[model samples]
Target: MLRVAIQVKELISSNVTSALDSMSSSAKMLHQLQREIEEAIIALEGERTKTERNLKRLKATLTQNEMREADWGDKAKAAMDHDREDLARQALMAREDCREAIASGKDDIAKAKADLKEIDEAVKELEAKREETREQAKAQSAADADKSGCSDAGASTAEKRLNRVSQMEKRTEFATEDTASARTNASVDREIDEMRRASTVDAELAALKGGAKKAPAKRARKKA
Candidate 1:
């Protein structure tokens, strides 16, 4: 079986390659999106600035119109008290016109403020999205790099094989030594057995001789 190190290294390399590819794609998309976001934000800001200025101008105009309306009312009141009916009517008409202008300006200001708030919120959301994309891309790139730099298992497997062969050689040497010792002990055992057999035969022969001598002695005693 192949060593785990080799297989794992291959897997890591392949996975890292895939991860890097994905990261690259993500980065490209992020770049494009960031550009779009920036453009949109710029355009929105420009429009917002224009709208704010318009709103401010309208507000100032509205204030001036209100002041004019108040002046006209005062004039109308004075004229009415002085018995100038035509003059009072003209002032009252002018005041009504100013009121209408002020109302229109107020509406414009409100619309402009609403548009500015919406643009500001949109810009903030885009920024947040851009930040998230950046972080994700960074993490992916780091992971990919780590995977690509992984080591292969062939070297370790070769080392292990060498170690196993060395151990086997040592075991074989021990077995050879054991076999030689057993052979030496067997030769010594055989020699001791042969010597014991010869001693037994000699002892039997001596016993026979003694029996013979004793038989002769008994016969002599009977004769006497």
Candidate 2:
């Protein structure tokens, strides 16, 4: 039973290895796709970095514009107090232009940030996929090697055990047959002994009867 169990375990492992190997081609394809995705994501990230830098510059410019607008507002108020309407109008226009620049910069920054986040996530996902595929391949290779080795070892062990069991069974059967044959010979010998004893007793009884009959005849003849 122990040997049989080992053989069964080996067979199962071998089959599992075969099944996994069957998927090797598919796994390679997945690995390739994962690598491609990673490369593409890397390239996209490089581009995204440039965009992010541009967005950063734009944001800095926007901040500077806001400060300039505040300065312009103060100047415009002073101009109004001094009764210079043309100077006040020019200052207000410059402030409005700064506001528009700040708004445009904010929009660009928001879009760049969103794109960067998406690219980062894609890069992370691709890395995960690549790692997963590599681990799977390694595990499968190890399993296949182990299964092949175990199957060979277990098969040999099981065959030896089976042969031993068959030998034992044959020996047992021979012993039983021999014992039965011995019993048969013993019974035949006992029957022959009984027959010989019965024959001896019958011969003795016949001789005695013959002697008595002869004596009775002789006595009759003498009396006559």
Q: Write the per-residue lDDT of candidate 1 for residues 78-150, one digit (tens) a residue.
A: 6655556567666766776787688888888888888777767666765665465566667755655665442
* Residue 6, candidate 2: alpha-carbon lDDT: 32
My TM-score estimates for the predictions, one after another, are 0.49, 0.46
lDDT of 1: 0.57
- Report the C-alpha displacement of residue 198, candidate 1, in angstroms: 99
RMSD values for the candidates in order, in angstroms, are 58.4, 56.7
lDDT of each: 0.57, 0.55
> Which residue pairs in model 2 clash with each other?
none
Best prediction by TM-score: 1
